[model samples]
Target: MTHTLVQDEAAIRALFTSLVEGMRERSPARVVARYADDAVTFTLAPPLLNAGLDARDPEAVAGWMAGFDGPITIEHRDLSVAVSGDLAFVHGLRRLAAVPVGYPEGFSMWTRITVGLARRDGQWLITHEHQSVPFYMDGSFLAATDLEP
Candidate 1:
């Protein structure tokens, strides 16, 4: 029983690592595979001003890959993960970078992200993820007012 549990943990870690790599590659197909067919994503952007939830069908998820103009990069830190039965969650700090339109150079942002995973049919997969940027008065990343949408 202990051996089986250890194996499960390793498998889950591998899957999560793959998912991160895929995100860095800006390959939506790889990212979508980590989620269930009916998985939904909520994005918090200032322009959107509200939490926008999108039901990710295969086509929708695949199309999302087209939105990136250039490669995406993610650096993870202080990663903590735990699994309970068929559910698992990972939390950590991330440095995210991407090239936006009209910008010759890319920009990087730091944030904290929490990912929720569920095991289905003995395979671990991500079900949900939420990212938040902490606002500090010390002028670290972004100010609290900057986060206002």
Candidate 2:
């Protein structure tokens, strides 16, 4: 592998790890810091499409974290990252587990995530993020939340 490829891979890996850590800390600001100022996202929540920097507002993250009583843990598996020049993308399965404050002691979710990054100057910043779960296509548009990766 080329030196640039290795460095790019490491940079993307660090960004991914930082996202997990930020989520665990329940700090949306920290998580959003990995993105570019004009970043866009397709989140798993309702109104899935989020555009512009406001899309990464800490409030959105806070709303999601509010459901969990205990600390939440996030893990990504089967990750694959590719970089070419100043652009890169990463895709993987993400697992999020937590105990809702008012719900069952154990609750978990599995979803797919893809991130697009752009190298500006000497830094790599996420420009796009898409996260989603499959849904039933037979009449009912029910999300497959019970499934595991």
Clashing pairs in 2: none
Best by lDDT: 2
Model 1 per-residue lDDT at 92: 79
lDDT of 2: 0.86
lDDT by residue (tens digit), candidate 2, 94-142: 9988888888678688999998999887788989989989998888999
Q: For candidate 1, give the lDDT.
A: 0.65
Assess each prediction's global lDDT (C-alpha) against the native: 0.65, 0.86
lDDT at 80, model 2: 98
Candidate 1 lDDT, 57-137, residue by residue in tens:
445545554545677776777777887878888887777677766668876776777877788877787677776766776
TM-score of each: 0.71, 0.89
